[model samples]
Target: MPTGTILVADDDAAIRTVLNQALSRAGYTVRLTSNATTLWRWVSSGDGDLVITDVVMPDENIFDVLPRIRKMRPDLPVVVMSAQNTFMTAIRASEKGAYEYLPKPFDLKELTTIVGRAMSEPKGRPASPAEETNEHIPLVGRSPAMQEIYRVLARLMQTDLTVMISGESGTGKELVAKALHDYGKRRNGPFVAINMAAIPRDLIEAELFGHEKGAFTGAQARSSGRFEQADGGTLFLDEIGDMPMEAQTRLLRVLQQGEYTTVGGRTPIKTDVRIIAATNKDLSHLIQQGLFREDLFYRLNVVPIRLPALRERLEDIGDLVRHFFMLAEQEGLPSKQIDQAALERLRRHRWPGNVRELENLIRRLAALYPQDVITTSLIDQELSQPAPSSLNGEDASQNLGDSVERYLNGYFDNFGEALPPPGLYHRILREVEYPLISAALAATRGNQIRAAELLGVNRNTLRKKVKDLDIQVIRSSR
Candidate 1:
């Protein structure tokens, strides 16, 4: 049984009553208030062992009062509750020294657990708040899925943990990375991003760890690598699954030793940049295929954040659509409103391109359409137009050559003037084989012979692939 007093402040009488009941039942003496003023009085008088307050209050915003309370009673754990549930709300709660930030409509049992945990733990001074910024919203959507992400991101904003973000393309991996860097401890440092898929395999090492002049045939001048440039900041390795084995080894060494040697240079340079890698591909599958290094995967998988696909969170489509419209307006595009029916229609979409696809649709609606309010008909026409096939080569309506050519065109477009690094054939083959073989194995349920037959390959060749790919085989026990 708990023995300390728990002070809770909320503007709503129902909330106060409910919390009072819950905490009292949990064996704590509960003091409830409908305003921050009374809560401050209780805290200033040192009357409570724990504090639960909402972000908004009748007399004052709790954010303004939290710092004063922290200074006066550093040991009192303050848990923040809010109905807003936006990314900023969670971050503000963390920055204001809240022990935990629970969104409104949170589970009562979860709240009690958090309170109990706070009470049992030894009280200590909270982390000092980082420099404040009134930057534009870096993320949008208040769906339950997004709320969970916001909570995780808030907790991570103050740490230097290496994060691995995996999601479908256009799912805002880069935005999440930027949010981490923009609001994190290293906000002041530069955020450098490198796309492994976009860069040639041979050039990846040099691109990441800059080359010394005269080291290679084309070496002209000593160049700083992303590690050197992002020293004290973050290095976002986009499409990390596409990184070659040799480069993966070098990256693993850097991660292990906290130092790297510039290509064609001897002295080891120490670096202090946080690593945040993102990939749309299935890295585990890649690992099984012996493409990605298992050691490197473990190093970067320290804090994995798998973003939910757009189709998985259809509830957020409305919010995302509105956010994109607002952005379009800010960029001198005409203002647009999407009808509820249109939003519902959007929810039904498979959204193969994810948020990026939705954003493009919204942008086009704002730019091309003459109407102020968008209707289901407009959405119908847009969605009806043949969406360029997914790069995964899933749509069989197009010929293989056409699909490969389209994908290659886009891949080449990523580099404006310069051509992609050499050795494109092996890369393309690996990309195609990865999905094809995985599909065969999945359909056959890890039966090598069946998979080989399905793929029309010899059993021995399939066995070698299974070994070389390190693919995990789970036999069905039926």
Candidate 2:
């Protein structure tokens, strides 16, 4: 006797044969069919322990039949296979209540394991109505890396799991967050995003948890924070690694108690908002450095999704380029097409700034180039120019000064007519010194001597500063 009767459906005879053989070899009896009609008959008659069906079939659409199958036999698990392999496809499979979704060219062993699990596991809830999507897709690319991300995001859309997205800057972390909110159960709710790095450190709490009138000198009226504003939706905390330690403590409390109070309000407001945080920095490293709270990290990292950098998914560069081109045209830029050679050239270069960098380059090409078609030579010329960071040596310094100026202005603004506390010089210097020294040490591969030289300070002074600041240094081979 076989372990179970498995029904396999695919338009391709070769695929049906492959699945039939694979399942048979795994000690299960397999029934093969090339159309959805036979598969539905088997499912409706309760003749099969499990059903594996392709999305596209000759006579019937699988997605259309899946909900009916679920209605007739709610306990029968249906595994969906698709060659389309887009994010929308994965979402549809999930929304239609697939036991598991396998993209084409999947590993045979993985399918077998899914089959075993699906047969043994208890029955799941019936399929929910599929959510409608607009024309705009927040994420693109069908690369294997992106497919995995899509599968994870699809599963997460129906739940309120707190997700932490870790990736390098400009890797579309915000886009991922927005997608989760737009397609999730909270689709009808608002999505409020706040950049931790953009706000002054002292004001972070007020920005997140709101403030009452007369809470501070700047509070002329009551203000609702991101959390209160997000109410039944999602609160996206961008650059979460840049959050001050004090705010992390407060955030942890909110996550723990599911409620929070404003800056001067005594009444605790219940919070029903979902949290989705993104960070380019390593939270583990920051935790070790005592910069990030470990407890808060655990709270927000319940469902962690690490986005792949552009270099890791070069296969999707062509798709991403075309997407940007379409977006540019929609924005009133001249229609432009990139030749195959130019696209290949783009794939060869290291995209240090990731997708955002590519998007900017595409927009620039569409705006600046006169030709309707872009060539490899033009691509080379655009890429040869120094990156925005390297365009001017003073850019970094100017940005740093501007950030400091903005913070000071906010600080003064908060005080109204009053001056900030005494010892302002030392306080500000210490704040600047820590990151500057840490960055220098990181740049020098933790070589104290090299860091000291780079900072134009004595080695002894650098060592003492490192000790005082508790900056961990792991020296690398010179």
The numbered model that scores best in lDDT is 2
lDDT of 2 by residue, 1-478 (tens): 3398999999898898899888999889899999999988888888988999999999998999988887888788889999987888888888887878889978889999889888777776556556556647678888889999998998898999999999987788989999999888999999998877545567889999999999999899999999999999999998898888989999999999999999999999999999999988899999998989998999999999999999999999988998999997887777899899998999998988798779878976775555789999889877896422311257788976776787578656745775644556765676567668878877887667777898899886986787555444544456
* Candidate 2 positional error at 13, Å: 1.5
Query: Residue 291 lDDT in model 2?
Result: 87
Candidate 1 RMSD computed on C-alpha atoms after optimal superposition onto the true structure: 11.0
Q: Relative to the unseen true structure, what is the C-alpha lDDT of residue 368 in candidate 1, on a scale of 0 to 100? A: 54
- Number of backbone clashes in candidate 2: 0
TM-score of 1: 0.81
What shift in Å separates residue 70 of candidate 2 from its native position after superposition?
1.4
Worst 10 residues of 1 by lDDT: 469-478
Colliding residue pairs in candidate 2:
none
